[model samples]
Every structure is written in C-alpha cells, then in structure tokens.
Target: MKIAVIGSKGLPPRQGGIEHYCAEVYPRMVAQGHQVDLFARSSWIHLPWYQSCRFHGVQVISLPCPGKRGLDGLISSSLGAIACLGKRYDIIHFHALGPSLFCWLPRMAASAKVVVSCHGLDWQREKWGNCSSCLIWLGEQVAIRCSDQIIVVSEALVDYFQDTYAVEAINIPNGPASYWQSDPTFSFVKLLGLEPQKYLLFLGRLVPEKCPDLLIQAFQRLTSTGWKLAIVGGQSDAPAYQMNLFKLAAANPNIIFAGELKERYLAEIVRGAGLFILPSNLEGLPLAMLEAMQEGIPVVASDIPPHRQLIGMNRGRLFHAGDLESCIQMIDWAIQHSKEMKKMAQKAQEHVQTWYGWDGITAATLRTYESLLCPPRSKVKPATELIQR
Candidate 1:
C-alpha cells in the first residue's frame, strides 16, 4: 500500500517520541513491501525544501519550516497536507494532534483513508501558549470529525476520547527502540562520573510537563548517599524550564545534566542506571519508560494513568503525581530495597518483551489500515456510528 506520513520532526529520530515512533514503525512498514513517504520538517532534516531522501527504505521528503516552536509544526503540516492532495495515497497517516489539524485536507481533496494517531493531548502541555493550545485542541476536534480511523498510544487516551468527545479510538501502544549492549568496561558513562547502578537516570525531553524540576527538587531532598542523579535529554522549546532545572540542581554536585545521549551512549547510561524515574504529570505511554523496563531497569513513576498502566501490578513502583514527598519516598524505597526492585525489574522486562514488540505493533497498525480499506462485510457498525454527536 502507498502511505503518506505527516506530523514527525524527521527520520532517524534525533529527539521526540513522535519522531522515534516514525523511525521504528514506518521503516518496518517499508520493509514489509509498503511504499511510505514521510513528510518532514526542513528544520529537522537541515535540507532544502522539497528535497527527498531515503531512510531504511522509507522515503523522507523535507518541507519548508520556520523552525519556530509551534509554527514549525503548523507550517510543515499544512504544506504536507497540501502535498498529499496531489498524490494517490492509499493512506495518509498523521502522528499527533497538532498535525492532525490538516488531516481534513487529505480526507476532502484526496482519495485516501485518513488516520490520526493521537500520541498525547498536546493542548495540555505547558510549553504551548494559549493560541497554540487552542489550535491543538481544534486539531483534535477536526481529527474526530474527518479521519476514517483514530489511533491512540494508550488506554488512558482511549478513555479520554470516549469520555470527552464520545469518540471511539483504536488503542495501539508504542514499542521500545532496540537498545545496544554497551561495553562492560563502562567507558562512556564513566566520563560523566556515572557508575553502574550508582546513579538514577531520567531520560526524556527536558520539558515542563515531564517535570524535570520536580525530579531535581525531590533528588535534592533525598536522604540517600553515594547515588547521583543523571538527567539525560534535549531541551525541546523549553530552554527556560531546562534552565530552571539546572538552577534547582545548582547547589547539588550529585546531579549531572548529560544533554541528550543517543544510540550506544544512551544504552550504556540506561543499562548502568540504578533506577529509571519519570515523574511526568502527563504522558502517552512513555517510550523511555518502556525502554528502561525492557532493559530490566527498575522504575519509579508518577501515578498518572499511562504510568500506572505500565508499572502497576508489581511491575514497578508509583508515587503520587506532583507530590515531592511521595516521589522522595518511592526513590528512597527503590534504592534501599535493591532485591525487591530487581525482582520487579525482571517482571517489567518480561512484560514489555512479551507484549510490546515492534513487529507486533507494526502488524497491528497494518491490520488497522487493511480493515479500513477492505473492511469485512459482516454486520459491523459504520465508522460514523462510532462517534456520538
């Protein structure tokens, strides 16, 4: 099938869950003999507008972008939507709510089945201002109205759509990216003064929603000794928040801000970690946590729905969301009770490996596309019936 993808930074996934998600799923789709053309931002690809390249068999076309935080996605997605209008794509898949704003264009102008994957509720993110948040919200509404099928990354999102918009969305969770086993000598992390099982790791974008500041605050108040905090991520349009985090950790020499480690470096840090903590107030089935669990690293996350879904049932520990005391308690417990945390890590590793493989995720996505295009003739409810006015 010919597919057109929109709403990702670019291929090879420098940062962001949507980008990594595209890098994993679409390439696999290409390997399965599907033609996938991904529309990307020139800001990310650093290429001339309209220039195209191939990554692991998937064709990535760069579109003009201003490189601004919110405007970049808006302009790129608009152009991407217009570009799809001239093509004969079987499926035009949009990755996030911001880009799904233009999903209506392909639905109305092209002969394609539009699919919108709601990775998260972007409107609730603190980085986006009121105008940007409103635009994102409108995109969500537009996606509900225009798309042939909607895909959500977590059951929490499924419940969100049903309760808020009365819309039925398919739940398809994200899979972990392949991790390389780093050198046992621990050369890379040792450069940052991080020792194996002697530091806690927080891996994700340094954003307000992810609450790196909260982690820093909690880490400062911890009663533990000899253990350091290694915060690894890029500041995505949240430089001020990132700066604030740095300030919060300024007095504490134990906190190390190792900006954005990828591939082997990332693998080493994660593998060497004593614990992986994500105190996010919001999430769409965090891929970072998934990767940590897949590596058999114990986790301590906020009591958000997505985190609970991943870590509940003794898979990992959870603390009250946004509570400093709760976070401190969980971290201290996980550190002190090493044997119990190791057992939970084993269970989490097994759970993710068994349930969240990329091949299975790709296959499930393809099945969703096929069902939309060649739906069975058995007595089934129409797509319109799935949405309540």
Candidate 2:
C-alpha cells in the first residue's frame, strides 16, 4: 500500500509525541512492504522546501512553513494535503486535530481512504489563543465529517467522541519508546550533580497544560528531604511559561532545569530518578509517563482520565489535577512510603510491558488500514462471518 502521512513536525522525533509516534509506527509499516511518504515541516527539518530524506526506510518530504506557532502547522498541513492530490495513495493519514482540517482535500481530489488520528483536543490546550483554538475546533468538526476512520489514543477520547458527536473512533493507545539502560558508572548524571535515586524527575514539554510550575511549587513547599528536583524537557512555543517556572524554582539551588536531554543522557537521567512526576491537567496517554513506567520507575501523576486509565488499579499514585496541596501530599506520601511505591512501580512496569509493545500497536494499525481497503462483501454481515466460512 502507498500511504501519505501528514501533521507531524519531522522525522528523528526531537520533541512532540506525534513525531515519535510516526517514527515508531510508519517505519514498521514500510518494513511490512507498504510505502509511506511523510510530509514534514521545513522549519523543523532545517531543510529547503520540498526537500526529501529517508528515515528508517520511510520517505520524509519537507514542505514550506512559516516559523510562527499556529500558522506553521496550518500552512504545512495545507501544502501536504495539496501534494497528496498528485499522488495515487491508498491511504492518506493525518495525525492531529489541527492538520485534519485538510483531510477533505484528498477525499475530494483523489481516491484515497482518509484516516485521522486525534492525539488530543488541541483546542483545550492553554497555549493557543482564541482564534487558533476556534480553528482547531473547526478542524475537529471537519475530521468527523470527512474522514473514513478516526483513531484516538485513549479510552477517554473514545468516550468523548461517542458522547459528543455520536461517532465511534478506534481506540489505540501509544506504545512506549525503546527502553535504555543507563551507564552503571553514572558518568553523565554526576556531571549534572545528580546521584542515583536522589532526585524527582519531571519529563515533558514545559507548557502550561503539563503544569511543571505546579510541580516546582509543590517541591518548594516540602521540607529538606535531600531529594533534588530535575525538570527535563524543551519549551513548546511557551517560553514565558517556562520562564515563570524558572522563577518559581529560582530560590532553590536544588532545582535543576536540564533542558532537552536526548538519547543516552535522557535515559541516564530517567533511570537515576527517585520518583517520576507529571502534574498535567490534560493529556492523551502521556508518552513520558509510559517511558518512565517502562523503566520500572515509580510515578505520581494528576488524576486526569487518561492518567487514571494508565495508573489506576494501584499501578501508581495520583493527585487531584491542578491542586497544589493535593500534589504536595501525594509527593510526600510517595516519598515516605518507599517500599509501597516500588511495588506499584513493578506492577506498572509489568502492565506496560505486557500491553503497550510497539510491535502489537503497529500490527493493530495495519489491520485497521487493511479492513478499510478490503471491507466485507455485505454491509450487514460482520467480517468474522466471512472468515468463518
């Protein structure tokens, strides 16, 4: 099958979840004998417009885009959709609500089956202005009306679509990134002034919705426990919010802002953590938390629906979302109860390893694509019925 992918920033997955997801899923599809052309942003790739590159057997084609926040996504998606009109693709897949705005272009101009993957409700995010939010909302409506299939990352999102739009979306959760073993010598962590199992880690984009500020404030209120706080991630067009978080941690020398550690450095930091924390108000199955859990690290997260789905049933600890006091209490409890936290970490690691493997996710996604292409003979009969015969 020939597939055209739209809505990711670019290949090597420097930051965003969508890019990482594409990096994992699409290349496996290529290995399975499907050709995938991923349309990316020139701004992200740092390449000239319309330049093409290969990433793990997938063709990544960079398209022109403005450097502005909202405009970049809109312009790149529009151009990607326009490019799809010239190709004879079997599937035209889009990644987020913002890019799904152009899902109609392929359906109108070509004979491709359209698939839209909603990572999250971007309109609900705190960073976007009202105009951008409204545009994202409109894109959601367009995706519902135009796309042949809709894929959501969490059960909460599946319920949201069912209740709000009376539509059923395929529920496919994200798989964890490759698990890494840090150097036993702890060479890199020592340079950062961190010791193994002596620091709390917050790993995600420094955005308002993720609420790194809440973590900083909560950490500040705790009495001296010899546990340093390491905030590890990049800014996502939210420099002001990131700056405010720095200010929140300004008085404390123990608070470390280790900006964007990739590969082995990231692995070492995550593995050395005493506790992993995410105080997010919104999420669509957080990949950071998933990776932490896969590393067998104990997690403390806000009690959002997606978090509950992942960490509920005694898998990990949860605090009330956006409540500073609740966050403080949860962190205190997790720290004090070391043995219990370790037990929960073991359970969480087992759960992720059993259910969230990337190979399974890729195969499930392929089945969805194949089902669309080779649908049952009769609309009233189930596909299973044909298989039974």
Candidate 3:
C-alpha cells in the first residue's frame, strides 16, 4: 500500500504525540512492504547535516509551512492533501481531527481511501482561541461525515464520537516505545542530581491543558522534603504558559524543569522517578503515561476519561481532574505508600506489555488499511462494522 501521512510536524519526532507515534509506526509499516511517504513541515527540517529527505526506511516529503501555531496544520494539511492527490496513493491518512478539515480535498481529487485519526478533542484544549476551537469542532464534524474511517486512541473517544456524531470509530490505543529496565547507569539522572525513587516526575508538553502549573502548585503545598518534582518536556507553542509555570515554581528550588529529553535520557528519567504524575485535564491516550507504565514507574493521573482508562488497565492511582486538593492528596498518598506504588508500577508494566504492544498496534493499523482496499466479496459491511473488529 502507498500511504501519505500528514498532520505532524516532521519525522524523527522532535515533539508532539502524533509525531512520535508516526515515527514508531510508519518505519515498521514500510518494513512490512508498504510504501510510506511522510509529509513534514519545512521549518522542522532543520540542520544541514541531518537530511530531511528520509527517515528510517520511509521517504520524507518536506512542505513549506508557516511555523505559527494555529496556521501550521491548516497550511500543511491543505498542501499535503493536494500533494497526495498527485501521488496516486492507496491511503491518505490525516493524523488529527484538525487536519481532517481538508479531507474533502482528497476525497474529491484522489482515488485513495481517506483515514482520519483523532488523537484528542483539540477544541476542548484551553490554549486555543475561540475561533480556532470552533474550527477544530467543525473539523471533527467534517472527519465524521467525510472520511472513510475514523480511528481513535481511547474508548472515551469512541464513546464521544458515537454519542455526539453517531459515528463509531476504531479504538487502537497508543503503544509505548521500546521498554527499558531501570538501571544505575542513568547519567542524565545523576547529572541532574536526581536519585532513583527520590523525585516525583511529570513528562509532556508544557501546555495549559496539561496542568503542569497545577502539578507545581500541588507540589509546593506538599510538606515532604525527601521528594523533588522534575518536569521533562518542552513548551509546544506556549511560551507564555511556560513562563507562567516557571514563575509559579520560582520560589521552590525542589522543582526542576528538565526541558526535553529524548531516547534513553527520557527512559532513564521515567525509570528513576519515585512516582509519575500526569495532572492533565485533557488527553487522548497519552504516550508519556504508557511510557511510564512500561518502565514500571507508578503513575498518579487526573480523573479524566483517558487517564482513567489507563489507570483502570494499569492499576495506577487517579485524582479528580484540575482539583488541586485532590491532586495533592493522591501525590501525598503515593509518596507515603512507596512500596505499594512500586508494586502497582510492576503490575502496570505487565498489564501494559500485555495490552499495548506496538507490534499488535501496527498490525491492527495494517488490517484497517487492508480492509479499506479489499472488502469481502459476499457482503459489504458498514464502516462501524470495521471498527468492531
């Protein structure tokens, strides 16, 4: 199958869950005999030594796009959809609901099957302005009515699509990257003066909806001196929000902003943490949470549906979303009962390994692709029926 993937910044996955997801999935998809061409933004294709021509085994097509937050996806996806039409691809998959706003372009101009994967409800995110939110909402509607299939990452999203749009979506949860066992040679952790099981950790984009500020606020109130809070992610088009978090955490020397750490650095950070806290008010199957679970790190997340889904599967702790008091209480309890949390983390590793295997997710994604290309001869099933599998 020839597939053109759009809606992410670029390959090598410098930022965003969707970018990381494609980096993990598409290489394997190419290895499995599918010809995949990933469309990346030109601005992200930086560093003269590092070629943007290709990544892994997949071909990379760089398109000119404004690096502006709101305009980037709209411009890139519009161009990407048109570019895919000329390529005569088998599947033109859009990674987010926002990009699916241009689904009609491919539907009319190309012979390929259109697929839209909703990572999360971007409209509900606190960062976006009113107009952008409305546009995102309209994009969701466009994806539901126009795309051949809708793929979601969590059951919460499946319920949402079914309830609101009366559209059933294929639920393929995000899988963790390669699992790494905790070890003593964590140079990054050591360099940061962090000891294993001695610091609380939070990893994700420093965005408004992620509630990193809330986490910092809760951390400040905690009386415990033994544990420090380490935040391991970069700001995603939200510098002001990031500045606000830094200001909120200014007085507390115990809280360290680790910026962005990739690969083993990221793994070691997760592995060495005493407990991982995701105080996000909104999420659609956070890969960061799954990564923590894979490393046998205990997680205390918000009571949002997606986080609840993860906690339910991994037996981790949860607090009411955006409730400072509740978040403080959960973090305190997890820290106090360290041994119990560690045991839960171990169980979470087992459960996530069993449930969220990357091979299985890749295979399922392939099956979805194949189903669109080759339907049964005897009977034609509805799009919802394809999701049921």
Candidate 4:
C-alpha cells in the first residue's frame, strides 16, 4: 500500500518521540514492501526550501518553518500538508494533532485515507498560550472528530477522546528500543566526563509539565550523599524556568547539566546509567521512559497513568508526581536498593521483549492502518500477536 506520513518532525529521528516513532516504524513498513512518504520541516541558516530526499527507502519531504518551534510546528506542518494536496497515496497518517491539518489533502483527493495519531494534546501543554492555545485546542477537537481514524498511545488517551470528543481510538503503545549492552568501552562515558554508578539520570525535554525542577530538587536532597544528577534534554525555551532549574542545580555541586543529547550518545548515556527517572506530572506514554526501560536500566518514574499502564508493579517503580518528597524518597529507595532495582530491570527487559519492541509496535501500527482501510472486511489481529522477526 502507498502511505504518506505527515508531521512537522521528520525522520532519521533528529529528536523527540514522534521522530523516534517515524524512524522506527516506517522503515519496517518499507522492508515489508510498502511505499512511505514523510513530511518534515528543515531549518535553513540562509536558504529557503530545503527539499525532499530519499533515505534508505522512505522519502523525507522538507519545508522551511517560518518561525521558531510552537509557531513553526503548527504553521510549517500545515504548509507541508497544503503542499501535498492532490498527492497520490492510500494512507496519510499524521503523527501529531498540529499536523492533522494535512487531512485537508484527503478532501482534495477522494481515494486518500487520512488519519491522525494524537501523540499528546500539546494544546494542554504549558508551551501553548491563550491565543494559539485556544486555536490548537479547537484544531485538536476538529481534527480528532473528522479524521478517518484516530490512534492513541495510552488507554487514558483513548478514554479521553471517547468521552470528550466522542472519538473511538485504536490503542498502540509506543515502541521501545531493544536491549543492547556496550562492552563497557563506549567512548560516550569518557567524552561526557561521567562515571557509571555515580550519577542518576533525567532524560526528556526540560519543560514545566515534565517537572525537571522536581528532578533537580530530588537530586539536591542527595547532594550530601555524593550521588550526582545528570539532566539531559533540549531547551524548552522557557528562559525563566530554565534559569530556575540552573539556580537549583547550582546550589548543589553534585548535579551536572548535560543539555540536549541526540541519538547515539543519548542511548549510550541512558543504557550506561545506574538509574533513569521521569518526573512528568502528566504524560501520554512518553517515548523517553519507554526507551530507558527498553534499554534495561531500572526505572523510577512519576506515578502517572501512562507509566503505570506500561510498567505496573513488577517491571519498575513509581513516585507521586510533583511531590518532591516522594521523588526524593524514590531516589533514595533506588540507591539503597540497587540490587532490587537491577532485578526490576530484568523484569522490564522481559516486558519489553514480550510487548513493546519495534517489531511489535510496527506490526500493531500497520494492523491499525489496515483495519482502518479495510474496516468491515478486516480481521482483528490479537493484541500480543504480530509479524515477528
């Protein structure tokens, strides 16, 4: 089948969960002889119109984003969709809600199937404001209502749409990277000046919703105990909040700030960590947490539904969100019970192997697409069963 994926973020996973989803899933589709096209926005230092090119097998189409981030993400993505109007394809899957404006393409071409995967409601996020905020919220409601099919990553999201917008969704957990261990000679550690077992990790965007400050506060509680905290993620552009995090970190010498790590170094740093934590107050099945768990390090994440839905009691540990005391308690528990944490890592690895590996995710995603296309004629694939390696 011919497939077109529209999202502001492009493939090769330059950054973020949506990119990671596109990078992992589309390739698998290609290997199975399906043609896929992805729309991405490229930032040019001087020139305009950074065009599309073939990588591996997927065609990545790029357009220049007019403004920075939130504006650029919503605007450029809509432009990309507008550019792809009248395009030939069987399926047009949108990775995020902002990009669902691309569904306008299907209205122009009858045979094209349009889908919007609500990765998360960015409108509810702290980044968006009162003006564009309302616009995005309105856009999201319309996008969810009109799309041919809606895919949600977490059960909570599925219920949210069903009640709020009366939209039924196909539930597919985000893919997790397979477990791989470096032979302890990876140059990533020495380059970052980090020592294994000496530091804790917080990996994800440093944003208000993510509660990076909570992690910093928790790390501060452990300063006298000689445990260092390494916070790695991209800038959320909240200058005031970022500075606040800095001030909090500065008061504690054991905490280190390693900003914005990309693919290889990211996986290496996470895979080598003694522990990985997420302090998100709200989440829709975070890709970072899954990536860490899939990498087989022990996890102590916020007690949000998405994380709970993924790990439950056996696979990992959780603490109450936004509670610095609980965060500190979980951290100390992880440190004191390092051996139990490793056992939890083993359980997490087993869970990942059984469910969330790339193969399972890709198959589930394809099945979702096929079911949407075929509907009444389609046979339901069992939840755990998918085409295997």
Candidate 5:
C-alpha cells in the first residue's frame, strides 16, 4: 500500500511522545512492504523549499510548520494533505488531531482512505491557550467527522470520543522505542550514587500539568529518610511554575531535580529504579509510565482516568491528583512494604507482556488497518456468528 503518513516535526524523534510514536511505527510500516511517505516539518532555515529524504525506505518530506507549534501543525499537515492529492496514495493516515485541516483534502479524494489517530485532543488538555483551544476544538470536530477511522491510545479516550463527539475509535496504545531491547547493565543506585535499594523516581515533563511539585512536596513529608526522590524530565516552561517547583525542592533535601537525562541513560534509570511516580493532571496513556512498566518498575501514579485505565486497581498504587498528603502517604506506604512494591513490579511486567508490549500493539494496529481495508464480504452476522480464530 502506498501510504502517506501526515503530521509531526519529521521522523527522528528529537522530542516528545508523538515523534517517538512515529519513529517506532513508521519503520515497522515500511518494513512490512508498505511504501510509506511522511509529511513532516523542516526547521532548517537554509532550505529554499520543501525537501525529501529517505530513512529505512520511508520518504520524509519536510515542510515548514507555520509559526512553530499550533499554527505549524495546522498548516504543515494541510500542505501535506494538499500535496498528497496528486501523489495517488492509497491511505492517508494522519498522526494527530491537530492536523485535521488536511482531512478536507483527503475527503475530496474519493480514491484515498482517511484514518486519524488522535494521540490526544489538544482542547481536552488543560495546557492550550484560549485561541488555540478554540482552533483545536474546531479542527478535532472536522477530523472526527471526516476520517474513515479514528484510533486512540486508551479505552478512556475511546469513551471520551464516543460520548462527546459520538465518534468510534479503535484503541491502540503507543509502542516502545527500539532502544528498549538492549541491556544497558544499568543500576539506579550506582547512577544516582545512592545506597542500593534506596530511591524513588518521578519521570516525565516537570510542568504544572505533570504535578512534579506535588511529588516534591510528597517526598518532603514522607518519613522515610532512607528513600530520596529523583525528579527526571525537561525543565518547566513557565518561569513561575519552575520557580514554584524549585522552591518546593529547596525545602526538601531529599528531592533532586535532574532535568532531562539522555534517552539511553533514562531508560537504564527506569530499569534500575525502585518505583516510578507519575502525578500528572491529564494523559492519553502516558508513554513514560508504559515504558517504566515495561521495565518491570512498579508505578505510583495519579488517580486519573488514563492511569487507572492502564494500571488497573491492583497493578500499582494510585494517589489522588495534586493531593500532597495522599501522595506522601502512598510513598511512605511503598517505602515501608518494599516487598509489596517488588511484587507489584512483577505484576506490572506480566501485565505489560499481556497487553502493553510494543510487538502486540504494532500487530493490533496493523490488524485495524486490515479491518478497515478489507471488510466482511457477506451481510451482517450475529457477533457470535463470527468464527473464533
């Protein structure tokens, strides 16, 4: 199949989960003999016009994302969609809802099938600006309506789409990056220069939305002097928010804010950690937690829909979002009964193998595409009428 994959800042994921998702999935799609073309944004100021390059048989056409973010996604994907019309592609798979402006172009192309995989809706996220929120909501509405199929990362998101937009979405969680396979011979204690079996980890963006401050405060209140917290993620963008986190960290000697470790080192840290903490406000099946769970690290997460949907009630610990006391108590509980945490880690590893591993996710995604391309030939049959594989 000649597939045109639209939306993103080009293939080598220099940043963010969406880029990581494409980086993982695109190569697999290409390896399966699908001639995949990526429509991405080129940040090069030297380029005269759009440029094309090949990586693992996938053609990456890098165009400029207008105004760099919300505007860039909206425009670059639209331009890619316009160009795709003349390319005679079989499938137009757009990565995120932000690129919905292109749905119109694909909709007019009767020969092409449109599939939209919304990583998460921007408007639903609390981070969007007022103007961006309005624009995103409008775009997502068009995207959900025009696309032939919608793909989501979590059952919670699927429910959201079904209930709010009345759109049906096939659930497919994000897969792991290729680096997950190798053994880095990593030790969290050695890396942090701490005593063996002694530290808790909170990994992800250190922003207000991620609630790193809550984790910091929780660490401060915890009575366990033996256990310290390592806060790993990018620096917060909003200065005031960053200041707040730093101030909280200042009050607590046990909290260390290690900003954005390199990917390999970070993965090693995750594999070596005693526990993974996520106090995020919102998420669409966070890749960070999934990655941690894949490494068999027990998680202590925010009691939000996305986290609950992934971890379930028994798999790991859940504390109320932004509640410092609840988080502190949960941390204290984990520290005291280290054995239960280890058991939870084992459970998490098993759970990951069962449903959240990369290979399984990739296979399911392929099947979704297949189901869309090839429907049942006969008339509607009872759900039981379908033969079990």
Candidate 6:
C-alpha cells in the first residue's frame, strides 16, 4: 500500500513522541514492502545531504513552513494535503491533533482513506494560547468526524472521545525502544562526572504541561545528598516555562541541566540513573516514561491515568499530580529504599517488554491500514491481539 505520513517534524526524529513513533513504525512498514512517503517541515531537515529527499526506505518530502511556533504544523500540513491531492496515495495518515486539522482536505479531495492518530489532547496543553487551544479543539472535532479511522495512543483518550464526542477510536499505545542498555563506560556520562545509579533523571520536553518546574521545586525541597538531579530535555513550545525551570535549577548545584540527549547518550544516561521522575500533569502515554521503564529505571511520576497505566502499583511509586509535598515524599522514599526501587524497576521493565514492543506496534498499525483498504475481505491478523489495553 502507498502511504503518505503527515504531522511529524521529520524522519530520524530527534524530538517529540509522534516523530520517534513514525521513525520506528514506518521503517518496519517499508521493510514489509509498503511504500511510505513522509512530509517533513523544512526547518527540521537539518542535514545538507538529506536535501536530495530520502531517508531509510521512505521518501522524504521537505516543504517550507512558517517559522512561528504554532504556524509550522498548519502550513506544513496544508502543503502536504495539497501534494497528497495529486499523489493518489492509498492512505494519508495524519499524526497529532494540530496536523489532523487538515485531514478533511485530503479526505474530501481524494479517494484515499484518511487516518488520524490522536497522540494527545493538544488543547489541554498550557503552552498554547486560548485561541490556539480553541483551534486545536476544532482539530480534534475534525479528526473525529472527518477521518475514516482514528487511532488513539492512550486508553484514557478512548474514554474521552467516547464521552465527549461520542466517537469510537482504536486504542494503540506508543512503543518503547526494544531492549536497550547503556554502556557503563559510555563517554558522555563519564564526561559529566555522573556515576551509575547516583542521580535522579527527568526526561521529556520542557513545557508548562510537562511541569518540569514541579520536579525542580520538589528536588530543591529535598534534603541535600550525594545524588544529583539530571534534566534531560530541551525547550519546546514554552520558552518562558523553560526559562523558569532553568532559573529554579540554578539555585541548587545538585541540579544538573543536560539539554536534549540523543540516542546512545540518551539510553546511557537513562540506564545510569538511580531513579527516573516524571511530574507531567497531562500526557497521552509518554514515550520518555516508557523508554526509562524499558531501561529498567525505577520511576516516581504524577498520578495521571497514563502514568498509572504504565507504572502500575507493582512497578513504581506515584504522587498526587502537582502536589509538592506528595512529590517530595515519594522522591525521598524511592531514594532511601534502594533495594525496593530496584525490584520495582525490574517489574516495570518486565511489564514494558511484555506489552510495548515496536514490532507489535508496527504490526497493529499495518492491520489498521489493511482493514481500511480491504474492508470486506480483510482477515483479522493475530498481531492485533498484541496491543492489549
């Protein structure tokens, strides 16, 4: 089948869950003899060599877009929809609510079946202004009403869509890195003077919704110890909030700011961490949390549904969302109880491996596509069973 993917920043994705998800799932789809064309924003197409337009087996189409924060997706998706109108693709898959705003254009213009993957409720994010949030809400409505099929990354979202819009969506959660381990002798961690299991790690974008400041504040209130707090992501959509996080961390020497780690270093840092913490107030099955759990790192997260779903009672500790006292208590408990945390980490890793495999994600996505293309004759593939809520 011929597929055109939209809504991701680019291929070989360095940032965002949707981009990383596409990077993992599409390659496997291409390997299975499907032709996939990905539309990337021109600003994110950094490599000079990639200007010729191709990555992995997927065709990369770089389109110029507005450099503004919120306008990027709008402009890119608009151009991608225009291009798809002529390309005659079997499926035009849109990722995230922002880009799904344009899903109707292709659905109305072409015979291709339109598919929109709602990674999260973008409107709820604090980074977007009231107008932008309203626009995103409109996007969600369009995605539900216009698309032939809708894929949700979190089960909570399934309940949300049903309750609010009365729309049915297939739940397919995000997958983690398959069996990754950090090298103890990794140069990046060594350069930073970070020892194995001696620091607390927080990985993800620095945004208001993510609540990085909450973690920094909680870390500050904790009694001083040998352990350090390593923040492992760069700013995204919320510069002021990022600045506040940096300012809060600046007051304490124990807090180390390590911006936006990539691949080898990312895994190494996560593997070396004594504990992983995510204080996000909102999430749709965070990939960072999954990645950390897959690395067998014990976690302490905000008590949101998605976090609770991944880090069950047996796996890790959870504190009430946005509650400073609760967060501090959990962090101290996790730090003091080293042996128990390790046991919890092992349980979390086992759970992640059993459920969130990349191969399983790819197969399920393909099944969704096949069912759309061959509705009457398509047989349910056994791989669909792998994605158990």
The local lDDT score (0 to 100) that residue 78 gets in candidate 2 is 97
Ranking by lDDT: 1, 2, 6, 3, 4, 5
lDDT of 3 by residue, 269-327 (tens): 88889899999988988989998888888999999999887786548999999899999
TM-score of 4: 0.90
lDDT of 4 by residue, 300-326 (tens): 888888888776867788899888998
Q: Candidate 1 lDDT, tens digit per residue, 1-389?
A: 99999999898787778888898889889988999999999999998999999999999999999998788999999999999998899999999999999999998899999999999998999888899999999999999999998999888999999999899888878888888768888898899988889999999888888988899999988999999999999756777777788788989889999998878899999999999999999898899999999999999999999999899999999999999999999999999999999999999998887778877778778878888888973222332222111
In model 6, where do residues sit more than 4 Å from their true spots?
46-52, 178-183, 379-384
Candidate 3 global lDDT: 0.84
Q: Pick the candidate with the highest lDDT.
A: 1
Full ranking by TM-score: 1, 2, 6, 3, 4, 5
TM-score of 6: 0.93
lDDT of 6 by residue, 1-389 (tens): 99999898887776778888988889889999999999888878753422536677988888887567888888888888888998899999999998888898988889999999999998998888999999899899889888998888877888898898888788888988543455667668867777778898988888878887888888888874888888888757677778877778777878888897776778888888999999999999998899888888999999999998889777999999999999999999999999999899999988888778888888788888889999997744443485643
Cα lDDT, model 2, residue 215: 93
Each model's lDDT comes to: 0.90, 0.89, 0.84, 0.76, 0.74, 0.85
**Candidate 2 residue-pair clash tally:** 0
Q: Write one digit per residue (lDDT tens) for candidate 2, span 99-175.
A: 99999999899999999999999999988889999999999999999999898888899999999999988877788
Q: Give the TM-score of candidate 5.
A: 0.90
Clashes of each: 0, 0, 0, 0, 1, 0
Error of 3 at 121 (Å): 0.6
Please give the distance, in angstroms, between residue 18's alpha carbon in candidate 3 and its true position after superposition.
Answer: 1.1
Off by over 4 Å in 3: 47-52, 179-183, 377-389
